[model samples]
Target: MSQDRTGAGLGVDRQREDCEALAARNGWQVVETYSDNDVSAYSGKLRKGYRRMLADLDEGRATIVIAWHTDRLHRSPTELEEYINLCEQRGVTTQTVQAGALDLATPGGRLVARMLGNVARHESEHKGERVARARMQKAKAGEWGGGIRPFGWGVPTGETTKKVDRRTGEETEVPVLDMDKGVPEEFAAIDTGHDILLAGGSLNSWVKWLADKGITSTQGNPIGTTEARDILLRPRNAGIAVYKGEEVGRGNWEAAVSEPKHRAVVAILKDPSRRTTPGSEPKWFGSLIYRCGRPGCTAYAYVTQSGGRRYPSYRCQTNHGGGRHAQKLDDYVQDVIVERLSRNDAQDLLLPGPGDVDVAALQAESEAIRRRLTDLAGLFGAGQITMAQFTEGSDTARAQLEGVNKQLGRAATQDPLVPLVGAPDVRKAWDAMELSQQRSVLRELLEVTLLPPRQGRMPDGGYFDYDAIQFRWLRGPEPYYAK
Candidate 1:
């Protein structure tokens, strides 16, 4: 039995450790330990140790693979299937501390193994969906969702008082109070605790202060700079929760500091120069797109500093500094490129061709799904079906309706005319979209690259080129743009 402790979170690690301890008590010999860090389970792109373990298995190195659970092995269903096939070929047995043994040799065993694997995969996906939904709800409600607690705030609890000590190390039970009122209350107060601490001094100083007072997180780690910064910046401590990168409503926790305090701290942290201190030069187009054009300069084109002035420059980080080149930014550069690429002629290049979708059929399908949903609702309201039956039918109909709606939305948005003919409106819509949506659109439209600036003069004695630009029609470039 072995464990793959790759990319397991802190909570997962504790669970795995407990499982391992239990397995040890049962006298199961832990044969080998395979650990991979910061590896994505979603892609399963052959982490160093996992790849070696596969090779070892093929070479008859180990017969049994042990993990705390099936998910600890592989999160993706495709990867799980591939691993199961490998185990079967090698006549290897897998023993999970929680799910027990999964043998693939026998027909029944194989079925059970696949089912268990699928269950684990389904649970992972469902967990992600649940989290996303929760975050969306929180965001819509304008509450702060999960992240590190800020400096001045403490975790709100049901308890009225907590043990506290002054800077002099004198300990006493301090009464917690509601932020709006100055009077001490019999309940734990919630506020952005970490932000209050950061606003007072440097994160390093705060860490030392907490350590000197013997304060530690629930994990027993002394507060560090990273923790301190995380606490200050996290929206959760500001009486909001965030789930899956979206802000949600404030939690039921008591306030340690007011919302205004957290907002001020966040405003300062978001400004890179202020956060970094010593005020660096402005990065006007820091995350903006650049394409590479140099013959050997495969590096992405980006803005660079020259003579105390910022210019759109392309430098091959892979090559020596001599490979650097510059492109002038004129009033019409971005507008011209955007206009040209967004022209009617270029619409086909940006969007899928007619053969990619069937407009008439899609509309008919959408209408049919909507009708079915209406019928289901009518049946429920007419008392023709039981509530349970109506709910089931309505849910199925609604899901199908949602699917069709999503397909129609995608087609409408991706239609060539939508961007080319309605350029102004499209631009307005793009601006209105959230940051995440903007990122999605940019990825969809551009196969960007950075190229060395053009040196030759044009017929009009004007040399115009871009440090980086998108290869407009290309799906992706070879090797350089591997997904």
Candidate 2:
């Protein structure tokens, strides 16, 4: 078995050759070779090659194992003892090019192996600490620590300056990116995307624009919707250095977009209900609560387009079909809502009625259902349960879990807009808010209903009446009509 955590340069190949030479000199035939490249043995990372070698030894398939050094074979003392126990049981011996042979069959050999293991572990821990400290220092200094290329930036390459150590008379080359390493095309795209978002473009619109322009990710793959969103949210694209998820400070490189614009884009994306792609209609006022008002209808009205101009309206998905012009309806509804909240006792509207329904029991039920589903999955995987049984059980559990989750969501909904509605200038505060925020406020206030148009009257066109729009307040008395 041969293994190298970092397969940089010719180190792994040299180690392999050395192991082969040692085998040849000992007159032993190499039956199989196992290697795990770019894997770490000291970082609690799984070493596949090492595990495979242990399996081979356990099966009595290998009598001896050769490594470059003891550290290469083991770092943790616990791991060392486990391997030693395995070797002793299998009557297997270990040899290292640097530390000579280890005979697990003897007491002295075990002592030496444990001592070496401790030393290797101590060195590995200190080295890891040093590396972490160095990375933090680099982040604080606004210097890029080498890693995967960030979106909107190209591979960093620049000049190196030789600096001489006075006492030791030693010289070392220091690397630096005196000029920006960003690709002009990518930089421009980022700026364009930022501008589009600032100009009220949706995430869906931005991704479609990127696709139309043939803009791809750093790896030349077609940029995905989530990836595009992530690119816009990356702090590095805004010339900020982030370490361990927290923003450190401004970075050394030029920003692809301004900080303010970047923050705006972030705020927009943070809206949970914000649509990613352009919907059928450009305007979606009151989309948060627009519902079909037909008797016993439980369908949401979606945006539908018409003619050359886009018409924002909510049409039922079910056959109970009803629609309202988004602009006209919103205007009339907002006027009534503002009038209602503008009253002297408007602050009363923000008060909490009876306490929220406790979801503790429902949450416990959800967790229990999840555990049962996991157990079912295990039984199915082990062939203990038939496929049909597994499927039926999983589906039933999932449905129960979903119903519980929905109940929990309803229980957790609180009006964060209470403070805004209670403000002195409630309308001004509401107007300053984003559409999504406004929608949240509306959801807290009332349930909107869009009744189907009168018989034979088209739901579209300019002559739609105002009586179709209705609001049923959760706390206040009676529904408000947009007259």
Candidate 3:
């Protein structure tokens, strides 16, 4: 076990040479070599090479195990105990090139190994604490502590530059910096994305334009709509320092976009009331919900403007026909839905049907599925599983987990209509409900349809009649005409 996880870029080759020479001096034929690159022994992360070497020892493939140092092999007492047990089960011995010999066959040798493992564990933990403290101090000072290079910033560079020694008159090596050229483009892209968003440009259009202009993400891939949106949403892009998710203070870099613009974009994305268009509802829920009911016209309506006034009306964008005022359609359908749900028979529809359901068991199964997905990701990281297998396994596990969760959410919801239906003032109870709540109840019961406007002078609620709207009830009854 010639494990050298770090400092490998500098002297891993040298370490291997040393191990081979030591084996030669001992007249031992080095049957095999095992190494884990950039892996940590004490971090509880899976080390594939280390696991393979252990498997070999257990299966009688190899009886002797050698390492660069004790810490390279085991820094955790729990892991050491398991290894010691395995060594005892099979007649095995351990040795290190640096620390000389370890006779694990004897009790004294086992005692020494335990002591060394404890010391190694202590050192690893102490080093982690010191590093964390140092990082916190740097963050508080607003100095860049160096992480994944920010999109609009330069990558850190280091070189051995000559620095003159004052007394000896000799030159010494000093590190220097050189920045990448894409930083300016990154800054420019932030401004472009901000302008595009405010001007009501589509995210897909902006993403395509950025790709055409050779603007890419920090990973060098053509930026996606979500990534472009994230760049604009980052408060750090506007020169604000954040720690643990909250803005701590001003940053040390120049502002990419004004603070106002950054906040505006965030607000627009996060607002619950915000729709696809600035002033209206999302297309999926607007008049499109009552899709154009004209004979042989299968297209949904898209909102359009005329004579400098916006109409919340549905007209087929594809066929460009079957337009109607959305308000009249919604009012006719929603009122009928409220009246239907107020009936006593609706209670059974809202209530969960009789079935053998164990909430705790379902919850446990969901949690187990989630853990399996995590294990699949770990296998992908260790290269034990292909990306295709991981993706297929993960998606299947997620879907099962989602189904379980939906069952749980449904089981947990109290029937809001129960008390409303029982109340004397049912209409008042319906009126008091929030618009979102009202919409949710309506959606649970019916699917609505809107007919084309009649060719005549406008009626009290425009040329469209109340009969233009239709509802296909999902529960309690068949299609209910509003009349």
Candidate 4:
């Protein structure tokens, strides 16, 4: 029996013809033939002819099965195993044009079949890896790997190699003019191959253009507005590969459009208010500077306003058993905290001193991981190890690399701000920072506290005692005041 299919490959047709000729030469009678057209071998989920062949094998109608190669029989391992089992049970013989014959009844033949199947599996895996790596490399080089060229462009055909014309000094590549049919009288003489009508166009315009052209995608589906926009925005069209959030440029492939061109289109698609929003009202100095100090307090630090701006205070949201509230006005409390922080040697407590991170140690660790990876690759290439061994070693090296990379990143970040921390002008810098930046600096510096309102009457007849504030300074409680 011969299982030949259309849309498989020219190889399959040639192999089928060879099989018939070989059968004639060997004087083997042709028992049956099966054909399946326009079927995808990648997805073996459905094939009417294949299903019928299996049924024929089960009923002993077919004793022999032949194809171009083992992959033609089955692509997946599980499906291949099932076919082998079926052949074994039915005592059917299997043959291939490229891989030769197999008799399931004989142990030696079965071993050869299994080996060949394993080889095919390995070949498929290797091919997939090669293709993926090639795509990645191409993307990094900034080439359009593969896909329909975007609007305003066309794939260069024969004799259209040169992008620019020598005589006219104009681009000679095929340009996508108005996607719409029925050329206007004015644009009739315009060379579309050189001029794209939709220049600096929006996505909506592209959508309308596609609709007017009556052009569908390769999938034969009508182009939608979203699909049109996606096609325009695709980085692949610009000769760049986007992998893991990184864009790599391919060198050899032509970009259908330029990056700035696509960015302009994207700008039109974005909402107008994307960059404009009302600013937030300024809060007290330490309004959100500290997390709640109370062990069980789930609430965060917040500012409250009362009496039409007469009072602005920072307090823990969960201060009084969830529902109870305490109000501390901004001017009254902030002035006191500022005075206390200014009078004390707060800079010593606020700035992180030297010896926070060792740069040399981090660099050494990073170099060590790179050395280990190199060593592992060398070992694998020297035939001293298997793929499994190499993978294990590489994984460990990568983890170590990640750890050192994080440390290096942190060290690099610290280098910029470390010197400013202990400078004499640190207080001036802190006061000059925006409110949000000031809050960030304070949160990094201090752990703050809110003391309860004091009860009446001091021995000295002073309304409030500054020393009795009872605030615990966790770090340097530096207070910044406006000049």
Q: Which candidate achieves the best TM-score against the true structure?
A: 2
Model 2 misplaced stretches (Cα beyond 4 Å): 1-9, 155-181, 272-300, 303-452, 456-483
C-alpha-based local distance difference test score of model 4: 0.52
> Can you tell me which runs of candidate 1 are displaced by over 4 Å?
1-29, 34-52, 97-100, 106-108, 150-483
Off by over 4 Å in 4: 1-9, 35-48, 155-206, 209-223, 236-239, 243-246, 250-483
Clashing pairs in 2: 204-276, 204-277
Full-model lDDT for every candidate: 0.52, 0.71, 0.66, 0.52
**Candidate order (TM-score):** 2, 3, 4, 1
Tens-digit per-residue lDDT, 1-483, candidate 1: 122232224444565586678568777766656755446465446677677888889898888787777766777667777887898898898877778877777888878876776776677678778977777676546454444433344434445654423223344555443332221221122232333332222345455656766667645677766666676666555355455553334555444444445554555445464346533322322133444455655454444554454444444445333223343432233344355445455444444543565655765675576557557667888988889998888788768755654454343233222333346654554444333233334444455554444567745576654333435534323222212
| TM-score computed on alpha carbons, candidate 4 | 0.42
Estimated TM-score for each candidate: 0.33, 0.60, 0.55, 0.42
TM-score for candidate 2, please give it: 0.60
Sorting all predicted structures by lDDT, with the top scorer first, yields 2, 3, 1, 4
* Stretch of 10 with least lDDT, candidate 1: 181-190
TM for candidate 1 is: 0.33
Q: State the number of backbone clashes in model 4.
A: 11
Whichever of 2 and 4 has more TM-score, that candidate is 2
